[model samples]
Every structure is written in C-alpha cells, then in structure tokens.
Target: MTRAEIFKEMEEMFGLVPSMFKSIPDATLELEWSLFKQVQLAPGEIPAKYRELMGVAISAITKCRYCAFFHTEMAKLNGATPAEIEEAVHYAKSSAGWSAYVNGMQIDFEQFKREITQVCQHVRLARESMGPGDMSE
Candidate 1:
C-alpha cells in the first residue's frame, strides 16, 4: 500500500490522517479493511481485558492464528496475566457453543465498556489539565 493511499483512508476516518496507515494499502481489501478500521476505532463496551478475552475466544473458535496472537498481546497490554488470559480462553471454549452465551458475554462487555469509558474520560480530563490537546470536546 502506498503512503498516499493509506493517508487518504485515515483522513477519511478521523479527519486527520495517521502516517501509520501509509504502511498498508486501504483499497486492496477495502471491505475487510474498512471493517477493521471501524473495529479499531469503535468505543469498547467492556474492560480492555474482556475485549481481549472475547477476541481470543473468537479467534480460537474461528481458528485464526493471527488473531489469537494479536488478542494475546492485547490481553497482556490490558494487564491481564497469562493465567487469566488462558482461563478466559478456556471459558470461551466451554460456553461459546451455547446460544445463551451472549447474555453472559454481555454482562462482562457492559462492565468492560464502562471501565474503559471512565478511563478515557479521566484521560481526557488530565489532557485538559495539561493543555497538551483540545480534550474538552
């Protein structure tokens, strides 16, 4: 993907283009790429750990090695211990087959989302205090 192509897509998504986008082409797989872009930017409705757990579960179920690795990293970033992450995957394996898992999952999701939202708000507040960015909006 040419740098121009990536910047163009980033510009469209967040008003300002991120230079990192230039490392990949957005048009080559627009459909999947767009979905990925949305997922990356969409607000989380659960704790980052929970989201990472879900990602791991989904990846395991879907047998996506790349996603498994990615979510593992995310889980670690969210301060999840390796044992906890492994437990999350085990829980997913045990219950993901049931249709009622959504409700159970939603419980965790809501909590995670709330926590993340609070953190974001706090960060915005801190950023406001420092006047490093226009976080008031």
Candidate 2:
C-alpha cells in the first residue's frame, strides 16, 4: 500500500493519524503500519487487556516514557486494574533483574534449559496423575 493509502486507513481506524506514523519513511510506512496493526492494534490469540499490559511492561523495561504512558492508559481502557498494571511492571523488573544476574554471571544456557525442561515434565506428570475431580492434592 502507498503511504497515502495507509494514512487514509489510519485516519479512518483511529479517527486521526498519529504524528509517529507520519514520521515513518514513505518507503516503509505500509510495512511498518501492517506490523503495528497486526501485533499491537489487532485482537488475536491474546486478549486486548493482557496485550496492552504487556506493552506497558515492555515499555517500562525499555525505558520508553512515551510508550509506557500510552500503553498504561490503553491497558486501563482495556479493563486492566491499577494493581494488575503494577504487578506487570514488577514482573518485568523481576525478569530483568534475574536476566542481569544470569547474563552477568555467564550462566550455562544448556544447563538452564535442561533444568527448566525437567521441572516442566514433573509438573505435567503431576497434573496428569490428578483425577478430573481430585484437585485437592
């Protein structure tokens, strides 16, 4: 699609095209907007609320103030509670902190993968052993 066509679509979809879309190069505007619509704006396997919360978390981790603000508001509009938003940020922070430690210490990737696989297998087996109506244990 041409930049003009994409701009028209954006205006129709959003009621007003954002300046950020205008800043994208004409050569790449169509492709960039396609990706943005598919991943960010469109509803898919993930619900909109979680997707927006994920955006907020990612923006916070990346330290993008503009994206953080935008996504937080979007998440709230999509029915995310303040507590859920706070938890998402905390979860992002915890993941980043652990990543820093693991990468900084040069932890063994193969060992980590093996241990995670074993834990997953154990959990699967335990779940399978539980009878359909026996969730007590």
Candidate 3:
C-alpha cells in the first residue's frame, strides 16, 4: 500500500494515526506497518494477553517508560491481573540478573547448553513417569 493508503487505514482502525506510524519513512512504511500489524496488533498462536505481558516485560527491561505504560494498560485490558503483570516484570529482572552473572563469569557456552539440555530431559522424564494424579515425592 502507498503511504497515504496505509495512513488512512491506520487512522480508520485506530481512530487516529499515531505519531509512531507517521515517523516511519515513506519508503519503508508498508513493510513496517505490515510487520507491526502481523506481530503486534494481530492475534496469532500466542494470545493477546501473553503478548502484551511480554511487551511489558521487554519495555521494563529496556527502560522505555512510554512502552511500559502503554503495554501495561494493554495487558490489563486483555485480562492480565496486576499480580500477573508484576510477576512478569520480576521474571524479566531475574532473567536479566542471571544473564549478567553468567555472562560476566564467562561460563562456557557449550557446557551451559549441555547442562540445560540435561536438566530439561531429566524433568521431562520425571514428569512422564508420574501418573495423572501423582505428585513428585
């Protein structure tokens, strides 16, 4: 679509054309809008609530206050609880902390990958061995 056509569509869909869309260069507007629609605005395999939560987590990590605010509201609108939103932020922080530590320590990538795979396999096997009502002992 031409830039004008995309802007018109965006205005119709959103009731107003956001500055973010306007800021995209005309040459790349079509591709950028296509990706934004497909990934951010559209529902896919992942539900909207989860995707919004992820957006919140990433925005928090990136320290993008605008995105964090926008996505937090979007997540709530999509049925995420306040507790769930907070938990997602905590999860992001924990992951970032561990990532910093591991990378700082210069852990061997091959060894880390092998250990992670082994741990996953162990968990899968243990879960498979359990009956439907069985709790791990």
Candidate 4:
C-alpha cells in the first residue's frame, strides 16, 4: 500500500495518525503499519486483554514509559482491572530482579536450563496423573 493509503487507514482506525508513524519512511510505512496493526492491535491466539497486560509487563521491564502507559490503558480498554495491571507489573519486577541477581551472580547457565527442564517434565507428569476433578490450570 502507498503511504497515503496507510495514513488514511491509520487515521480511520485510530481517529488520528500518530506523529511517530508519520516519521517512518514512505518506503517502509506500509510494512511498519501492517506489523503494528497485526501484532499490537489485533487479537489473535492470545486474547487482547492478556496480550496487553503482557505488553505492560514488558514495557515496565524495558523501562519504556511511553509503552508502559500505552499498554496499561490498552489493558484497561480490554477489561483488565487495575489490580490485574498492578499484579502484572509486580510480576515483571520480581522476574527482572531475579534475572539481574542470577546473571550478576554468574550462575551456571547449563545447570539452570537442565533444572528448569526437569521441573517442567516433573510438573507435566504430575498434572497428567491427577484425576480430572483434581486438575487445575
């Protein structure tokens, strides 16, 4: 699609074409907008609410204030409660903290991967052996 076509479509969908998008080169505008619409705006395998909540967590970890605000509002638009958004950020904080600690400590990567694999296998087997009524997600 041409840049004019992409801009028209963006304005139609968003009520305005964001200035960030306008700065994209005309040659790359269509492809860039296509990817943003597909992955960020569309609800696919992951429902929109959960996906936006995940985006919030990632934005927090990456320290992107702009994306953090955008995803938090999108999460609300998609029906995430304030508590859910807070919890997602807390989880991100915990995960990021542990990652920093582990990497800083210079832990053995091979051992960590092996242990995680074993834990997953064990949990899978345990879940499979549980009775239908005893199983929970």
Q: Which is the leading candidate under lDDT?
A: 4
Using Cα atoms with residue i matched to residue i, what is each candidate's TM-score against the true structure?
Answer: 0.48, 0.81, 0.86, 0.87
> Which digits, one per residue and each the tens of the lDDT, describe model 3 over residues 1-137?
99889999998998989898888998899999999899888989999999999999999899999999989999999999999999999999999999999999999999999999998899888888998657554
If both were scored by lDDT, which would come out higher, candidate 1 or candidate 2? Answer: 2
- Residues 85-129 of candidate 2: C-alpha lDDT, one tens digit per residue: 999999999999999999999999999999999988987788799
Worst 10 residues of 3 by lDDT: 128-137
Off by over 4 Å in 1: 1-34, 96-137
lDDT computed for candidate 1? 0.72
Off by over 4 Å in 2: 1-5, 131-137
Model 4 over residues 7-44: C-alpha lDDT tens digits? 89988998999998989998888889989999999769
lDDT (CA) per prediction: 0.72, 0.92, 0.93, 0.93
Q: lDDT ranking from best to worst?
A: 4, 3, 2, 1
lDDT of 1 by residue, 47-116 (tens): 7777887888888878899889888887887788888888878887787565366575665777868998
Q: Rank the candidates by TM-score, best first.
A: 4, 3, 2, 1
Q: Between 2 and 4, whose TM-score is larger?
A: 4
